[model samples]
Target: MASHRRPTHSGLTHSARVTVLSAAAATAVAALGATPAGADPQTSPERARAAVDRLFQEAEKATERFNSASERATHLREELGQVQDGVARGQERINRLREALGSLAGAQYRSGGVDPTLSLLLSSDPDTFLAQAEMLNMVTERQHSALQDLQRAQRSIGQLRTEAARDLSDLERSRAAVARHKRTVERKLAQAQRLLNSLPSEERGAFDRASRSGRGVLPAVSGDAPASSRAAAAIRAARSAVGRPYVWGANGPSGFDCSGLVQWSYAQAGVGLPRTSQAQRYAGRQVPLSEARPGDLVTYRNDASHIGMYMGNGQVVHAPYPGASVRYDPVRMMPISAVTRV
Candidate 1:
């Protein structure tokens, strides 16, 4: 944040909110993977402290992976630039050598130029003849050496040019891989930042208490989905707020993930619900697809991970992913398993 921000008792600063969020998200992910039940784990402050420490450990691991990816991208970019420069310089040297060789060959082949033997025979006196002959031989030797020098430079440049081109090709592939890795790291960091920002200062003590004991009492939303008018109004309102970014687990004016947005919409209609889709599925009355109506809880995917509200005409207003805008998409595209009218 650019405004007033302070460090927490855990030695975490608000400006590093992304790191904190990443830690919390990592905790949620691991729990989803290995936790047997979503039970209350908090018993004491000491225990909560231990839990937060564990969460922080998870955060560190995720951060390490992100940094590693970023470093790889930087390395690839640097290597590419170096190799490209080498290729260009080698090409320039090769052209210059070729040009010099062409001029020297033309001079050696010209009809106006005489052979060493002919030049010696054309001299007027014996002394002059011997001297001119020796000079002619030296000139011939010099021309031969110059042509050889040009050939050697051409050969050296050709070999270097080949190596440089190969290096450049390798660098291009590495750069593409690095770019993919960079996108992953940036997305993870941004998601973590969003979660930390969602958990404001007021919740810190409570979060700390929960973390000490490996428990967190996620605040429930306020509203009811079964109330038709209010629920319909809420859903319509949510639809109007489309085109916002899909920040995972977000519920809001700015953006939200699938479940978070649905939960928030119902909350506006006076329904109270948990934050996760798995919990959301169990919050409302189960209804068959044939009986499903607008403002009903619609869940998809095996883990009940994705949720959306049933809009009329068989569409859903939901957040899709990290880099997407929340909008209405076909409900049929989702892996729907059940429906609930809250």
Candidate 2:
């Protein structure tokens, strides 16, 4: 059986992790107050906008964690199903072995009720007695072998059951982690929304407009061609998704998050990609930003929480974040971490 080991976030319990994350989020929101005390009123709008942007970034990180946990849960569930199926088949085999052993015992019971040695001694013909003795010995050996087979089968099933139980536990933990990360993401987004709402109408409109800036317009990408046919196909798929809503955790024709868009686009190109940006960062050979071509994955931030498909000419098509549509942005949007050529 394959190992179903899951990565742990911390030694903390699920509830404890939730509490810690919530507290951290609250502290961040407090520090990045909607309006700091005695601050320059003129820069309040700028400060608020910055704070909201930070919150959105934090939420994206949480969303990636959520994706990781969710993916783990999916694999664990699959492994659990396989283990359970093995146990069931093992049980059926054991039943057949049991029936065979029972039949052997019944044959022995229906035979003459004297000890084998006594029967041999009481037999009138020595040759006939010897032949009967050999047959009885063979029956005993077969019974012993059947018993051993049953014992081994039982042991194997026991081990499989244990594995299934362990997988179930891991699955539960993954589910908890998924829920916790989801809550963290929600909290961060909510804080950002509240901050945005607190801004003056004009400032809020500006923020909204900036978020929508990528909609309905795509920068002309020139210079380097896609490194591969698959890359080119993925780029075309991503471009077709322009103006789609940025739905967190979605990887589809309609909506997508950062890594989701990457994975979905690659999938359209008949290639597979990992579920999270952090993992997707290593999906292929790493290259410097200078070598980036259309369809290369351009990851952002040291943790690789954000990713976009490079479209050459210093442009990329990405699902920015909530309230934004999939659109074109500069490849240097948030400090390029790594450019991966898939």
Candidate 3:
């Protein structure tokens, strides 16, 4: 009867195979049950690094917004001050015009309500009175001019007052935005610090050492420095700040962000650059990376959140990130969006 044919495969009977499979499944379940804690070793560190990077990126975006709002508020304050001054001057001119008009009315009343010109024509000293009449004619012309000026000043004062009010309103809104951005940055940075603190001591040490290592040093000035005086000066200035701390919105000898470093370095060269990376990207003539010269700003990331000053020889000086200082990195540290010659 074909041995009631329980087929055999791999030299095992069907019953034997079934038993083996059951035992294997049970063993797998047991092994899974006995699995140790933290079986996957890579997850925590990877997640921590990714979280830190994400938080830092968010903080940077908020920092830029804060910087922009701060700059706008400053400009608005200056403009409002000028407008208020103009309004004060307009009021003064209006008062002067009123006083002149009053003087003219008083002279007419003193002339017995008759025309001053008629008084001049009937005077005994006719030639002398004629000279005085000429003077009076000049005064009359001046008074008419003052009246027109007064009307114009009044209109100007109205417009200036309106502008001043609008500027104040805008400034208040900008201040609110700045505050919001500041809060966002602080929260993100705090979260990042917490994530970083969670990293193992060895991993944290490695990360810190990496930041302090290779690329953070100043780049050597190559012989290929651009011939442009301003560009060379800017490059020199940027290089001089290689070890400065990174401070959001600072354009200074103390600390700087990416665009702040660029702006401040250019300022040292007597060149004016825009405040933010986005604006600075368009502030100068854009050039191809291959054609980039010393002092050209190399903007990174599609959003233009990062920038660095080209220091010739394929190196750039940049304020890399929060924990990193102003340093030299390869021009290809990140994706290059633009190279602008300021």
Best by lDDT: 2
Task: Indicate which candidate wins on TM-score.
Answer: 2
The whole-model lDDT of each prediction reads: 0.57, 0.81, 0.74
Number of colliding residue pairs in each model = 14, 0, 0
Check candidate 2 and list the clashing pairs.
Answer: none
> lDDT of model 1 at residue 148?
75
lDDT of 3 by residue, 169-277 (tens): 9989998998998999888888767655644454555556555443346557777667489998888888888878878768888999777898899899999887888
Q: Using Cα atoms with residue i matched to residue i, what is each candidate's TM-score against the true structure?
A: 0.39, 0.87, 0.79
Residue runs of model 3 more than 4 Å from their true location after superposition: 1-41, 110-142
Q: Candidate 1 regions off by >4 Å? A: 1-31, 38-99, 112-128, 187-342
Error of 3 at 19 (Å): 38
TM-score quality measure for candidate 2:
0.87
